[model samples]
Target: MDALWEGFQEAVRLIVRGDAGLREVAWRTIVVSGSATLLAMAAGVPTGYGLARGRFPGRTLVLSAVNTGMGMPPVVVGLIVWLFLVRSGPLGDLELIYTKRAMVVAQFLIAVPLVIGFTAAAVQALPAELPDLLAALGAGRLRTLWLLAREAQLGILAAVMAGFGGVISEVGASMTVGGNIQGDTRVLTTAIVTETSRGENANAMALGIVLLVMAFAVNLLLTAVQQRRRR
Candidate 1:
């Protein structure tokens, strides 16, 4: 208990002092995770809506694939991204490996299936009559989708929060794709690992605390948003 108290004090001191290294890691973590989450939402939300409303051939296969992807190992995601971005690989000419952009790409891929699967399930769970009612009103397909989305807004928000939660805490893909370079790609998770490995327990503990607090805050905010939507 004393150790924990001391760690908290140390973390507060660091934060109060504006610890340069910690701030840098926090900034990088937010940038990478935020960008990835946005990209995932942009792609996943529409795909999920389409899946919920349409019954084309191969739709089941696609949804199944998305569900499968949600369970994929982070290490595998890292390795695949690394391969594609590494020299001599198909996309090697882009030279995206071992960079912040690469980390964003990796996290984006990791979050996509999560958002899609969750959002699709959410949309499908709504009453079938909702879509039918929209159809009866002579609403176009696009407007119908929009109305359906509004009706299922809470679930879509939850899906986005869930995706953000996944990518925000991940270290495997971030480290592998970003190289965890100091003053560059290092994020809170990667920095914690690096500091811990080097016996900087105080710093590592501080970062861990910050990561937990930030994640908690994000979830709380998301919950509030969902509650507002429900009302």
Candidate 2:
């Protein structure tokens, strides 16, 4: 109880004072997670649309794999990324291990499956005759995709929320691949973990508060957009 209250106070102080390190961690959290979310959306949205519409062979197997990936452990994702990027690994010649780039990659892998799953579900929910109607109305592939996407913006925004939320809040993969180096790869989630590891419970909680606020703020913006679209 006392610890939580102390953490609340510390959180207020950190925010009011605009602590440099805290700000840095917060900003990096946004950059890395935001980048990952955007990349996931870019890659996953189209693929999901295809899955929902296409009739190619092995599609069921692919969707099943994506569904499995949606629930895969973040730490395992981190370990896989680490293995691929680590020195002496196949792609290690690029030397991206233990960097912000690596963190972004890990988070992207963590978020993409969720994006795909959500997008597929959302796209599949639309009227089955809608595609044929659009095609009959002379909408080409890209144009049809755009129109369908606008119609399904709500789910896409939901995917945005889920993707950003997933990456921003995940500590395991970020710490594992990012190495949590101060001023470089350290993000809010990893910072909280660092504080807790050293027994700084109050600071950990304070950082958690900051993380929640950040996530809430981003979600609020997306929700506002979603609701406006709904109206």
Candidate 2: the clashing residue pairs are none
List the global CA lDDT of all models.
0.89, 0.93
Judged by TM-score, which candidate is best?
2
* lDDT (10s digit) by residue, model 2, range 1-231: 988999999999999999998999999999999999999999999988889889999999999999999888899999999999999888899899999999999999999999998999999999999989999999998898999999989998998898898899998999899999998999999999899999999999999999999999999999999999999
TM-score of each: 0.95, 0.98
What does each candidate score in C-alpha RMSD?
Answer: 1.4, 0.8
The sequence of per-residue lDDT tens digits that candidate 1 reaches over residues 1-231 is: 654676687789888999888788888888999999999999999999889878999999999999999988877899999999998889999999888999999999999999998889989999989888888999988898888888888889988998999999999999888899999899999998998899877778888888888888888998998998898
Residue pairs whose backbone atoms clash in candidate 1: none
Off by over 4 Å in 2: none
